[model samples]
Target: MKILFTSFLYLIGGFFTQSVAQPARHRAAQDSLTAELEALRVQGHFNGFGVAIVSGKGVLYQQGVGFADAQAGKPYDLHTVQYIASVSKTIVGLALLKAQELGKLHLDDPIDQYLPFKVRNPAFPDVPITLRHLATHTSGIRDNDFYLSKNYYLRPGLPLAGLPMTFDATQTFIPADSAVSLPEFLRNSLTPEGKWYQPKGFSARRPGELYEYSNVGASLAAYVVERACGQPFPAFTKRYLLRPLRLRDSGWSFRQIDFARYSRLYGSTTVPLPYYATTTYPDGGFISSVADLSKYLHELIRGYQGRGTVLGPASYRELFRPQLAAGNFEDRNERNPFSESYNVGILMGFGYTGFIGHTGGDPGVVALLFFDPTSGIGRILLLNTSYDDRPSEATMYQIWNTLEKYQHRVGG
Candidate 1:
C-alpha cells in the first residue's frame, strides 16, 4: 500500500508538470508572435487592427496592436469594438437557419410570403424569388447607385465637416433623422412603385440563375427572417445568437454595447471618420472585438466539425454545404483567400483553397473571417482603417499572411 501511494503521487506530479510546461511554451510562442506583429504594424499603413487565432476547442491567441483612437492615445486591444462589415452576413445566415429549425420559415419558401411589399425582377417578373435565392446571393437584386447614396447616415449629433469626405461620394453620410426603417428602405429600393426604385435595381438575370453579391439582397433575407419570426431582427439575433455565445460586445448598433470601448474608424491612417450607420444594417454592421469574435470563430469551427452548441449538427451541415457550382459565378475570384465569391454555402463563403469564411469592406472598415477545415484552425482580422491605396492593401494581406505563419505555433 505504501508503494502504491508513492506511485500515485509521482503520477500526479508528472501530470501537473506537463500541464504547466504546455502553457509556458504557449506563452513564449505568444510573446514571439506579438513582437513580429508589432514590427509589422509599425511598418504598415493602417492605424489600428486586431487578430485572433482559433480552433475547435477555443481561442489560441488574440491581440490588438496600435491605436483604436490615435488622437486620444487609446491602445487598440483585444476588447476594442468596431464594425466587422460584411462578416455580419454570416450571422444572418445562422439566424435564417435557426428560424428554419424553429419552424418559423423554410428556405425554399418564396420571399413574397413574408415581405409586406412585392419584390420581383423587372427583367424576369414571372419568376418568384425564394429565401434560398436571397441567402445564396442569386436573388437578382442589385445595389444600384442609389444604394450607396441612400443607405448610410451619420449618427445623430456628429458634425459632418469634421469627418473625412475623400472616399466614394456615394458613401457620403446623410442626417440621422432622414433614415427610414429597414422595411421601408427595402420597399423603396426594390419595388417599382417606390421613389428610389430604378430598373437597374433588379439584375438582368433570373433569380437563382447567377451569383451577384448584393448587400440589399442580404438585408432582404434578414427582413424575411424578421417577418417570419415576428420579432425585430436585432432582438431575434440577440436572443438566439449573441446571448448563447456570450458575445456581449457585438451588436448591430452602438446602442447595444458599451460605447466607451468602441473604436474610432479611419478613412486613412491619419484621417478619422465620423460614426455612421447603415440602413441596411443586417448586411455589414456587426460590431465586435477580437476577444468576442475569437469565441465566435471557435463556435464556427466546432459547428463545422459537428460539435457546435448554437445549432444542431444537421443545421450546421446545411449552413456549410456548398450551394453553387462553378457556373454560378460569371467571374469567380479563385486566387484570393479573402474573396468569399469562390462558392457559397448559404451566406458563408468558400475560398479557392477550401478556406471557409467571408470578407467585408465598408467605408472605413475591413474584416476577414475564415477557417481552414483540414487543420480546424480559423483566423479573424478586423481593421478600423480603410486600405485605400495599393501599399495599404498589400500591408493588409501581409498582416494576414503573418498570422498564418504563426497560427500553428500559437495554436499548438
Candidate 2:
C-alpha cells in the first residue's frame, strides 16, 4: 500500500481523575517517561516537538520541547500547533464518515452524484468511483508527474490540477486565492471540457483494484462532503467536530491558531520555512497540538471500545477498515512499524495488538499519530523537521518499549 504522506478540543479523557486520584505507581511511570522524552529530544536535536500518551480513560502523559519560534526563543509546549501534512487525511476521512452518519451521503454512492462533474477512469468508464475508493487510495487517481509535466503551478486555463493543487504540503509557498478552488479544480479535472484535462490522471487499472496514493482523490472526497453537507469542509468540521469537542486550539489553518504558539518548521539550514495554506484544505491543511489531539485520541479509543465518541462507533469501524488487498506489498521494515495493508486513511500495524493512525512528512515537518485500542493506549509525536523518512529509529523503538512497559505496569 502506498504510504500517504502520510484535531480537536475536547475534554473526553480522564484528565481530572488521573491527575487527582491516580495511583502513585502510574504517576511515577509518567515522570520517568517524561525524562526519557527530554533526553531523546536533546540527543536527537529536535527543533520543536510535542509528545503525548493517551489511554482509553484519558491522557496519561504529555510534554513538549525545543522552540515554537526558535529565534524568538518561544518554548514549545502542549499548545504549540504544527501542520500535520498527510495526516490531515484522517481528519477528512472521519468527517466524510460523519457526513454519512448524518445521511448527507453514502460511501457506496457514485461520487459523481455529489460532484458537479463525473469522474470515471477513462480506461474503464463503465465503473463508478465511490467514496470508499477515494478513502482507501483505490480510486486510481494518481498525482501529476511534476518532473515530466512541470504543472506544479495552478493556471487559469489549466483543466488539470497538479500535485500542489492537492495542498501546500511541500510547496515553498501557499498559492494565491485567485488560483482554482478545490471544487473548481476537481470539476475541471474530472470533466472532459475543462482545461488541463488528461487521461493520464486516471489509472488503467479499475477503480478499487489498485493502491496508487492520490491527494486529488482525498481532496475530491472532501469537496463531495461539502456539497452533500451544505457547508465548507473546515466550517463543517468546526461545527460538528472541533467546537463540539471544545478543541479551541486546533483548527484547519494557521490563521485559526495562535501565532506565538505555532511551531516554526526547520530544515537542515538555519532559516525556517514559511507556513502553508491550501485551497484543498481537506487534504493536508489541519493544524493541531498534542493537548488537543489527545482528546481526539481518547475519543478514538472510546469508539474502538464501542463507547462514547464524537464520531459514531460505526463510523470509527468504517474509518479503520483495512484496505489492503491480499497481494499488496507491506512497507514494514526496521524503520517503519505499519503493516503493508492500508486502512481507510490511517495505517495498520504496531505493538502487540496493532495500531490505527497516520504518519506525515513534508519539507520541514514530520509527525505520527497512532493508537493501540486493544491496549487502550495511543501515542502522538510531532516534530518541526522532516529529518528522515520516519523519525529516528531509536526514538520509535523507545516509544514502543515505553508503551509496553507502561502497559505491563498498568495491566492494560
Candidate 3:
C-alpha cells in the first residue's frame, strides 16, 4: 500500500509541472534569442543601445543596455547620447517648416533668392531652383559625393566669404581629383574652369527630372534656415525644437570633451577617426538621447495640433507629411539585422499609413524613429553600433512590431 501511494504522488507532481510550465516553443525561442543577444553583448559586440516608447503622452518604454564606455565602466542609460547621422535631415526639414510658419521664408522660394551663391549652369536658366526643389531634392544639383569623387585630395578647408557654415569640419572633402568648394566645384565640372580640374562628364539636369540624393541639397536647405532665422543651424534648432519640447539632455553641438560622456563609436574596435563633425551637419549631424527622441516623435505625431508644445499642429503636420519621393530603397539586402528599407525624398519620408518619421545610418551608429498615423504613436531606437557591428534596420522593425502590439494595452 505504501509503494502504491508513492507512485500516485509522483504522477500528480509531473502533471502539475507540465500544466504550470511555459510552452516549449515559447520558452525555446525566447531563451535562444536571449542567449544570442547576451553572447553578442559579452564579446563587446554591442557598445550601447537605447530605446523609448510613448503612449498617451507618457513614456511606456525607456530602456538602455550595454556600456557607454567600457574602458571606464560607464553604463548606457536614458541620459547617454550618441551621434545620429543622416537623421538630422528630418529635423532640418522641421526647422524649414517653422521658418515658413514664421513668414521668414517659403518652401517654394528659389534657392538663389535666399542664398548668395548661384549655380553656373546656364542651360537651365529659366528653371530656377527653389527651397521646395532643395527640400524635395529636385534642385538638379549633385550631392557632395559627386564633388568628392572629383577632388580626392588633401587641402585646408578655409571658410570662404559669403557662406553660413552648417557645421565645422577639420578636413575638407575632395572630389578624388579636384580641390574646390561647391561654387568652385561647379565651375570646374560644368563650366570648364578651376586648377587641375577634370570633369566627371556629367551635367546638372533640369529640376524634377527624378530623385537624386544631395548633401548639398540638405546644406542649402539648412542655409535657408540660416537665412530665415539669422543664426547658425545649431543655435536656431535649439530655440525651435529643444527649448519648446523640453528636451533637457539633447543638443545640436558637441565639444571634444563630449567624447568622455559620449558613447564611443566602434566597429569590432573603436574608430581611429570616429569624428561626427561635418559640413553637412544639417544633413547628417546632431547628438541626442533616446528619451528626448521619443518626445520629438511625440511632437511629430501630434503635429502640435494643440496637443504638444514643440510646434503648431498645422506646421507639425506639414513636417511629417512626405514632400517628395526621391528614390526607392531595397532594405532586405542590408547586412545589419536591424536594416530596413526606407525610400528618401525631399520634404517627405514614409513607412506605414503615409509618412512615418525618418531613419539614418552612419559610421558607427544606426537609428530609427517610428510614428503610426492611425494610432498617433511613436518610438525611437538609438544604438551605438548596429546591433553587432552591422546595419540593424530589420531589428528595429522587429522592435516596432513588439511595441505596437503592446501599445493597445497601454491605450496607445
Candidate 4:
C-alpha cells in the first residue's frame, strides 16, 4: 500500500509540473504575439482594434492594441466594445436554429407564414421565399438604394460637420427619431404597397436560384424569428444566446451595454465618424468586444465539433452545413481564404480555403470571425477604423494573417 501511494503521489507531482510548464510556455507565446501585433498596429492605418485566438477548449489569447479613442489616448483593450457590423448576422443564424429547435419554425417554411406582411419575388411572385433561402442569401431579395439611403440614422446631438463625408455618400444618415422599427422598415423596403418600395427591391431570379447578399434579407430572417417565437429579436437573442454564453458586454444596441466603453469609430486615423444606428440592426449592429466574442467563438467551435451546449448536435450540424454550391454565386471568390461569399451554411460562412465563419465591414467597423474545422482553432479581428485605401486594407489582412500564423502555437 505504501508503494502504491508513493507512485500515485509521483504521478500527481508530474501532472502539476507539466501543467505549470504549459502555462509558462503559453504566456511566453502570448507575449511574443502581443508584441508583434502592437508593432503592426503602429504601422497600420486603423486607430484601434481587438483580437482573439480561441479553440474548442476556450479562449487561448485575447488582446487589444492602439487607441480606442486616439484623441483621448484611451487604450483599446480586451473589454473595449464596438459594433461588429455584419458579423452580427451569425447570432441571428443561432437564433433561427434555436427557434427551430423549440418548434417555433422550420428553415424550409415559407417566410410569409411568419411575417405580418407578404414577401414574394416580383420576378417570381408565385415562388415562396423560405427561411432557408433567406439564411443562405439566395432569397432573391436585394438591398435597393432605399436601404442605403434610409436605413441609417445618426445618433442625436453629434456635430454633423465632424462626421466623415468622404466615407460613403450613399450611407446617408438621417435624424435618429426618424428611424422606423425593424418590421416597419422591412415592410416598406420590400413590399410594393409600402412607400420606399422599388421595382428593383427584389432580383429577377427565382427565390433560391441566385446568391445576392442582402442586409435587408438577413434582418428579415431575424424578424421572422421574432414573430415565430413571440419575442422581440433583441430580447430573444439575449435570452437564448448572450445570457447562456455569458457575453455580458454584447448587445444589439448602445442602450443595452455600458456606453462608456464604446469605442469611437473612424473612417481613417484622422476621420472620426458620428455614432449611428441601423434600423436593420440584426444585420450589422451587434456591439461586442474581443473578450466577450472570444467566449462566443469558443462556443461556436465546440458546436461545430458536436459538443455544443447552446443547441442540440443536430442544429449545430445544420448551422454549419454548406447550403450553396458553385452555381449559387454569380462570381465566386475562389482565392480569398477569408471571403465568406464562397459558400454559406445557414448564415455561417465557408471560405474557399475551408475556413468556416463570417467577415463584416460597415462604415467604420471591420470584423473577421473564422475557425478551422480541422484544427479546431478560431480567430477574431475587430477594428474600429475603416480601411478605404488598398494599403490600409492590406494591413488589415496582414493583421489577420499574423493571427493565423500564431493561432496554432498559442491555441496548442
Candidate 5:
C-alpha cells in the first residue's frame, strides 16, 4: 500500500512539473527579417548592405541585399566583403586587452614606455599620457587637420593625404618630395622636431582629464600593442582573434586578402568609388563580410556569458563598462554613458538596458555591431554607400526597432 501511494505522488509531481514549465519556443522565421532588410536597401538607395542576427551559441541569420557590383550585375551575398571603417577600432581594443592578459603590456603604462617616439601634449608636457587615456579618448589628442596643412600632401607615403584625392575628382593631390612610413607619420605629426607638428593637435586640458575623439590616439594604441607584443599589429591580431574566431573573410589590407570578393564602394550618386587604404590601419581599417562578423560577434557574446577562453572574463567585463566617469562624454541617443576605444554602454535596440558595441563610418561605408550581455543577442548592419550628409539618427532607431521585432531568437 505504501509503495503504491509513493508511486502515485511521484506521478503527480511529474505532472505538475510539466504543467508549470514554459513550452520550448520554435525558432522565429527568417523570412520577415530578410524582406525588411531588402526593403530598407531599396528605400535608402544603398548599393549593397548586409545584416546579421546573433545569439550566444552562433548566428541566427545573415542576409545581404542589392548589388555588390552594379555594372557586373553581381548580386551581393552574405560573403560579400567591404571595409567596416571605424568598427576596426573595436578589434584593436580586443587585441590590446589580449596583450595585457598575456603580460605584454599594462593599461596604465605611459605612452613613451612602448612608442618609439616621445609623444606629449605640447600644452601639458608634465602630465603623462597612458594607454588607458588613449583607449578612452582622453589622451588629449586631436585630428591632424590634415587637409588644412600645406604638407598634408607632401608626405608621399602618408595614405590619408592621397585618399581624398584618389576617391574624389574635385579634390586636388599635391606631389610630395619624399615618402613617409606609418612610424614617420606619427613622429612628424606629434614631435617637436617634425615639420608637420602642430600645437592644435592636442587639447588645452591634461591627459585623462577630457574627451576628444582622435584617430591618431587609437592608431597609436595599436602601435604600442605591436611594440609590446613583439609582432606586427595585423599579424598578432590575426593569430589571436581572427583565426580563433574563424573570421576568414576579414583582414586589414587589400594585398593580403582575396580582392575579388570585395564589394566596390559607392557614393551618394551611385558612382563607384576607388579603394583607399590608410596608414592608420588600426583605427578604421577592417574589410569583412556579414558571415565572418557573425562568428566574431558570437565569440564576443560567449565571452560576455563567461564561457569564452580567448579573453579572460574580467577583461571582457571591463571592456564595455565606462572606463572614465568625470568629464566623460555621454550620448543619450546611443545610450552610451562613456566611450572606450572599442566598447560603449549601448541602450538602443537590444531590448534591454546596458548593452555594448561599436559603430563605424568612413566616406563610403557605415557599420554597426552591438550585443546584449544580459540576453546574449546581437545585431549587425553594414552599408556600402555614403551620402553627402550622413544618415540621421532616425535610421539607427528604425533599424533597432525592426531587428528587435523580427530577429529570430535561437536557443533561448
Candidate 6:
C-alpha cells in the first residue's frame, strides 16, 4: 500500500484441506470458518485476525479469532487493523475513477501531460505511456521505481535487508535489519530520472508494450493524482475516497510510535532473523480493520453503488480491465484444464468468470479480495499469517465452484 518490496522467494505453501462441512445458514458455517482461523493462530500467524462476509445489504456471516500481538497476548478485536498491502491499488483505481467522474482528469491523458516533473514522455518516438497503462500495469517499466535516480546503480553485495526503501519495482528488497525512514523511501522514488529499472537495468520500450508491473508506475500515478487535483496523496485519497466512504480508521502515516496496533513478522527460523522484533511496513502501508475492509469490499462489489457523485459503475469496471500483459508469468502458458491462471501468483480474478481485485503479501500478511459480477458474491480473506503459497486463488475458485456444485446448499 505504501512501501516498495522486492520479489520474495515464494516457495509452494500447504493449506489445510479439510472440507467446510457446515451449512451456510446453520451456525456450523461460522464455526467451521472459526476453526480454520484458530488453526492459523495456534500455528503462530502474524498476530490477531478478523473476517466477515456481507451480502445484499449487511454482513451475512463473520468471524474474528486471534490476537493483534502474540506475546503481549493482545487479542485482535473487531477493530484490530492489518496492512492491506497491494489491495490499496484498487482503492487508488477507484479514486482515479472518482476524479474522472468529477472532470478533474481523464484516463486517456498522458503521464507527462499532468506532471510538473518530466514524467514518462509517451509521445516521444519510443516510450509512449499513459494513465491507463499505469492503472492496468501495461507500462513497459519492469519495476515500481519511485523517483528513480538517473545515476542510480544497484550496489554489489547489497544485502537484501539493507537496500533503501523504494517504490522502484526493480530494486530488489528483503526485510531490513536497520532503521530507514519512510520519507527516505518516498523520496528515493522521485530520483534517478524516473526510469523503469535500476541497480541493474530498465525496460527501454514505451508504455502499452507489455504487462510489466511497476510499483513506481503506481507511485507515480499517486503523485499525478496529487498534482492533477492540487492535493497531497494521502489527503486526496481521504477526501475523494476514504472520508466519503466513512473509513474512520483508514490512513497512510509515517509516525510509528502511536500506531501500535500491529502483528509480528514470521520468516524462516533457519534464516535466524530476530523473531517478533523486525518489520518493514512501507510497501504495504495502508492499514484498516477487517470490518472496514468488509465494508470496502461490499461497496466495491456493489460498484460503489449509487455513489455517482463518487465514481460511476462503468468507470469502476474499467479499472480491472487488463491494459498490458506482464511478461515472465506462468499462468498464460500453463494449460491446466482444471487449474486457474494467474498474474504472477496473484491469481488474477479478472478476465475469468469472477471479476478482479488483488491479493497482497508481505512477510506476515496475505490478503485476498474477489468480486463476482454475476452473483455479487464478493470474498475478502485477510490472513494474519504469511500464508505465502500461491494464495488460495485456485482454492477460492474451488469454493466458488463448490457453492455452484450445490447452490441449493448455500441457497445462492
Kindly give the stretch of ten consecutive residues in candidate 6 with the minimal lDDT sum: 8-17
lDDT of 2: 0.65
TM-score of each: 0.93, 0.82, 0.70, 0.93, 0.81, 0.69
The per-residue C-alpha lDDT of model 1 at residue 65 equals 96
Decoy 4 TM-score against native: 0.93
Best first by lDDT, ranked: 4, 1, 5, 2, 3, 6
- In model 4, pairs of residues that clash are none
| Candidate 1 RMSD to the correct structure | 10.2
Model 2 CA deviation exceeding 4 Å by range: 1-20, 146-178, 327-336, 339-353, 388-412
For candidate 2, the clash count comes to 9
Q: Candidate 6 lDDT, tens digit per residue, 1-412?
A: 3222222111111011123544446445445556655664555423445655544354444455665555566777656666676666666777677677778788878877877554443333345467777766565544443323221222233343632333135423333333233333433433354332253223454455555555556656666677788877677877877777677666765232125555443332112112221122222457776667766766665653433334576775565444434363423533332222233211132433334556565435656555554555555555554433344333333333332332222222
lDDT of each candidate versus the true structure = 0.82, 0.65, 0.54, 0.82, 0.66, 0.49
Q: Which residue runs of candidate 1 sit more than 4 Å off their true CA positions?
A: 1-21, 335-338
* Superposition error at 275 for model 6 (Å): 13
In candidate 4 the C-alpha lDDT for residue 185 amounts to 94
lDDT of 1 by residue, 267-383 (tens): 888889888888999998888998888878888888989999899999999999999998888987665544557788989977677878787888778888888888888888888
Q: For model 5, how does the per-residue alpha-carbon lDDT over 85-200 read when each residue is reduced to its tens digit?
A: 76687787788789999999898899898988899998898888999888877899886655223222322343343234443432233455433456777888888898778889
Residue 365's C-alpha lDDT in candidate 6? Answer: 60
